[model samples]
Target: MRRLRPEPLTPEAFAPFGTVIEADPASAIGINAGFTTRFHALAEVEVEGGAPILSIFRGRPRPLVIDMLERHPSGTQAFVPLGGRPWLAVCAQAPGAPLRAFLARGDQGAQYARGAWHFPLLTLAAQDFLVVDRAAPERNVELADLAEPAQVALDG
Candidate 1:
């Protein structure tokens, strides 16, 4: 197995995938103070293997972080960290706008940006992640003629 650590997470880097964990106003914010929130079930493409494969970090102590992969004239994306060490695996497709990744130590994955590309939540040990995304009759996808790639790393 190989050790994969991408450069600082960025929307341009995560263009191939959709936004990862996003904001949830309903989910429990803490032990007792939380508002209504939403949940992700992994970004789907309505077909068998039509989406990107959930790549596993294959390492231990995965570090998860609360980062934002934003897209500007490129697209939107999310950086979901898996495992204890906090490794991130984004699940997104076709970026259309510019995005930014705001990752931190105490942050959790949240909602998908409007027109922002995103991915499913990936666990370091597991090659599977539950994601939240949007796919309607009208799909939002884009290609970067001259795009750059970003990597996600958590300080967990």
Candidate 2:
């Protein structure tokens, strides 16, 4: 097994794989008497020919181990945390390419581009998330098993 430590999530570092959705009052359009701020169009959502589906996912914390990776070739997938808890994201350029790990806070979210290989949701604590993706009739997942699993580590 290989050990890997995740780096802090930033818009620049995550740009290659997808967009980093963050709330910035400076970049937001104020509405409702300036009481609320909205960061609009934070991600490039692609659904191909399928319809977009909104779903909620509750994930339990688990050890960071990448035994396999999966990808969606038909559409882009986004995950936003509903609860204020930090999480981890692992992604790669392709099925067998080198992997990169990112640490995201509760307020941050990510949208992965089509065909980008990634691991499933990972959290240090249990958390709920809003997931948006394409709903297609055919299978859209492409999975690959790694010969050597990658163990994820986090630093303060």
| TM-score per model over all chains | 0.31, 0.94
> What is the C-alpha RMSD, rounded to one decimal, of candidate 1?
10.2
True-structure RMSD for candidate 2: 1.3
- Judge candidate 1 at residue 106 and give its lDDT: 19
1-156, model 2: which lDDT tens digit per residue? 787889888999998888887896557887899998888778877988789899999989987889899989999999999898889889988766788999999899998888888998888788898999999889888899987789997754
Query: Worst lDDT window (10 residues) for model 1?
Result: 45-54
Q: Which stretches of candidate 2 lie over 4 Å from their true place?
A: none
lDDT per prediction?
A: 0.36, 0.87
TM-score of 2: 0.94
lDDT of 2 at 80: 92
Q: Per-residue lDDT for 1-111 in model 1, tens only?
A: 112233333434543443334344443244324553335343332322133223322333334432333322222333344332333444333532333333322134333
RMSD of each: 10.2, 1.3
